[model samples]
Target: MNNRSQISHGDKSRNTRLGRLRDLVPVTSAIVGIDLADAKQMVVVCDHDSRVLARKTFRVRAWDLGAALDWAGQKAATAGFAGVTVACEPTGHRWRILGQLAAERDMAFVCVQPLISAWARRGEDLTTDKTDEKDAVIIARLTAQLRCYVPEVVDETWGRLRHLGARRERLVVELTAQVQQMRDLLECVWPAALTAANYPFRSTTWAATMTVILDRDGGDFTRTKRLGLDRLENLVRKEVIRWGAEKPGLRITRNLFAALDDRAGVIAHRRGALERVEFLLADWLETRRRRLEVEQRMVAVLDGLELTELVTSIPGLSAIGAATILAETGDPHRFSSARALVKHAGLAPRERSSGTFVGRTKVTGQGRPGLRLAAWRGIWGTLRVNPVHAARYTHLTTRGHNRLKPTQAQAAVAAALLRQLHAVIVTGRSWDPDVATFGSRRRPVEVAA
Candidate 1:
């Protein structure tokens, strides 16, 4: 035989042996479901075939992660398969390290919805006893069917902005509560001050009014002879000059004077009423100032983003409004449809139907409350300036539903507004009243790049 033939035959014989070995190999891969907690995490590693490879508790540390990854890799290699994919349920901000570990190891990482896991466990078993081992298995099975989603990975910049936005909301709520408390405090002695102030307890002007009244030598103006009404009017004008900058509007000063008139004979003489009002007014002012600071930061952060311009193009949506909506909703395209967005925001209609008999449907209110609040606030702003929205509001209130109340009609309009917002954001197009209001024969708008 020739040397070439001999070499070729030997090579063929070697390839046959390798092919036989490959056929004998069993394909194996793992899906990890980690039930994350504050101190220790429950890690469940299961094969693609739904067999548990390892279930153990590990402290959240670098060493434990390395150990888990090594174990899963060894198991997969022993079973003659590819590498494993890691999954975890996001419990607040605890999943960040897990994601980092997966990325470093080049494993597929996913977040399973807590609701999905909890729902499955509860329905499959009647008891609510939480077990890490069982949850790990459930997560693995559900993940096999792609029952998980990629969470929003907020970078440092957006994370700071998100914190600021949350802070602003908290301050607003606190300021509102303080204002209500101030109203009650004053009501104990002077019930007419709110009427005279022509504003709520937390109104910036209301606090300013108290400041002026407090600064006067006669603290309780109800006596009336001490600081006359005209002098109080002078203080209002001074405030407009002091904080109003050089703005051309006198509406605040005018309102302040009108409120001062209401302040006449409205002073509370009780020491408790006086002290509480003073304390609450000062707190309300401070909270309002902090809220303004948060707003400024939010606007700055939103302006820095690549997408804010597209958002601001919607009429009546300032930078603050745009920031709130974007932060709460994440990416508009992530949602399958506008209806899905509504459901995520807890605005989706809930049906009370069984068989052919149908009951009244209402919004679930189970989704993100912040998103719903931001949506309604955005709608209110649109209604004020957009003639298109104004016209829609008019039609909705009058002819949309014969039996719908005014609030229900408004709610219907708000839902439409959410759908339109999704369209505007996704299409990268400014709102066009002509296209939105009039019947269109044109092609649908394309999503932006």
Candidate 2:
């Protein structure tokens, strides 16, 4: 045993208590705690009294974890221990593989919070020095004290949906940045073009018009003077005619001609700076198109899952949004209550009260940020469209006590929506907008009469 794991000469009283604890605990139970990492893990096995029986560091591989468990169990068995529970700090997805192995081997497994593990490691000892071996032993002792919970694993479809949703979000951001870049380039080259049409980078109707400008045979728009204005105009006219004659979506192409024809002459000479603007602009459009395809796939996947109809029945919640909620939240069965679900998304109101001073309630914002953002989007959409949630928003604003600010109002509505969704999830009932009941009920505050 390491000196750290031993009761020191100064701690004789604690040593007596440890002996009592060791006697009280059944000889059958053992705890195997692991300090998880991306590349390797430090493991410690301890029987009832926080006494380290075995400690080892091994590369993070399935076989290594399996062999470590077997070796630890044998070590415990020699010490008259039978039952074993494996645990580790929740270190992102690093623990998943170990958890899965434990599950497969029929061993109990749990995850302790990193904060709790850290505090446990330094409690009273003020042990400034730290190592994987020490942390692993600490985790084992804490786990034996029942200081951990099981981590929930999401379903395969939900996992895919989450990745797709994340990708779509990134693509949307990229598209927005690209559009802004295109607008800036056009503003420099042709100020009148964007002035004619506020959102030219929308890439539906204006795409055809942009194609005409880009299809010029000469290197850049500066060559338009060399090609003569008539030839350039003729090229644009022919492209517009082709769009009208050949393309399926050209019905909207007609609107682009006037903007292009009017603004074409604004940039008399080309900077040659934005030669690939049209191509890059079209690439952004293509990214948006891919995002739509992903949304469609998400809808298809969500349609097959339970509680999806329940989720989508809420006003302003689309099937995609519903899928995002389910995916980001994992299985709702893991949450003990609707409030737990709300807290999981960090939507629960946090209290900030000190002596003689009280701070306004604010959402904790401590959980899954993506889930909170998804709920926020739903709240925004609901405020715009859903009468039930809108009324709830109105109620929140009109509350006699500390009426909510606009931002607070949004957070309140989002929390309410999250709770409603949670209720629908747990109760396995579809959201009924026509028979709105969840967020629609609030009694007026009684005032001095």
Candidate 3:
């Protein structure tokens, strides 16, 4: 007749799936599931056998956090349990506050993946309807069955690297968008501008020429023709000199004139278009500057870590890339093995097959995306410079019977890179090219010089 008693299942076979996790949640322990929210949290207490004991909602405050823990602990004690495991789905960053509160009391705080909790909800209720109360109980049940893991606690240094890495990723995405917009504008107004020399946006010459075009008669390609080749060359040289860069040569100036001569004739909204271009250029430059500043900070933080030297010892991994990856993977030594680290990075390959049908295998991609991205970016440089990685990539793609696609081979290499990174960091040894590859004993294949 009680709300807590109505939620029990009579299945005894589920115990077989617990396997080794039975030790983590003993019969004397209680599981406290917390559904974290921005303003309030839903807490549910359950015994080791998954019978709910008490459920309550607490406001989002430090005092309320302590009260929730105390209430769960009192319920746990009344239910004849000696220990408590605080569990949550880690919805956003709100769970950290509760987890921290639980940690201060020596309570075991664990996380159930959101995907796992969702599946458990569907399996439990036969309906998709959800509420914080239901989710809280589901989390407790999952914890009772030991379907959760304790998250790594990082120090202040790793915390700084993690946040900075996230900031840098956002800035890069914004800078990329702005650059694309600028390209579109150039295509509309000055089609020949891009064909001049493929000058990068960061180059001094490109910025100088763009400034000249924007200042001369409101960015009109036609007006630039009246300035003539000599005068235009002088203006660009002066602008370049003002930026402390070497002056553009006569040949470069001539190419600019030729490019402008082929520009599209006076189009409507030319003035508005130039104004938009000027705004975009200014905005893009500012974003680029901020991104560089973040990168510098990332490098500075990376310099203080002991793992930096070990990770960057690998030919292709840059200091910044190593910092990003390490930020996501707190201390690599905590991982049990290289395979464990690879799985943590979500680079572990997952195969799908049932009965007679077999499907293509791909990575699970269930791990930290930032860590995966850092490894992927590092692999690009590794393939270019590290002969061992290049050889492995080639073998994976060019193998006789099981040739992997380019992208698949890249994933494979990325996984291997993660494993190798864990290896060097844990073992405290430098990367050895001769022993790096999987099958190094075979005859050496000649790589182009």
TM-score each candidate: 0.78, 0.77, 0.86
Candidate 3: the clashing residue pairs are none
- The reply for model 3, stretches above 4 Å from the true place, is 1-24, 222-254, 353-358, 439-449
Task: Return the top candidate by TM-score.
Answer: 3
- What are the clashing pairs of model 1? 196-262
- Please list the C-alpha lDDT of all candidates, in the order they appear: 0.68, 0.70, 0.79
Say which prediction, candidate 1 or candidate 3, comes out ahead on lDDT: 3
Query: By the TM-score metric, which is better: model 1 or model 3?
Result: 3
Sort by TM-score, best first.
Answer: 3, 1, 2
lDDT for 302 in candidate 3 is 74
Over 4 Å off, model 2:
1-28, 60-63, 119-130, 184-191, 201-203, 215-219, 222-272, 306-308, 354-357, 398-401, 433-449
For candidate 3, the per-residue lDDT at 189 reads 72
How would you encode candidate 3's per-residue C-alpha lDDT over 204-275 as one tens digit per residue? 676667667777767667788887878887888888775447876456556667876664734675567777
lDDT of 3: 0.79
lDDT: worst 10-residue window of model 1: 20-29
lDDT of 1 by residue, 1-449 (tens): 47855666547655664454333222344677788777677787777566787777877653357677666667666765677777778877667777877778877677788999999888767787678778888887777656666566677776787787678778878977887787666666655556544454424455555666654523444543345656665665565344333331334434544444454343546445666677766676677678888898888887776666766666777778878776777667766567777877877778899999998977788878888888787777878887877787787667734556666655665666667678777777776766667734367899999
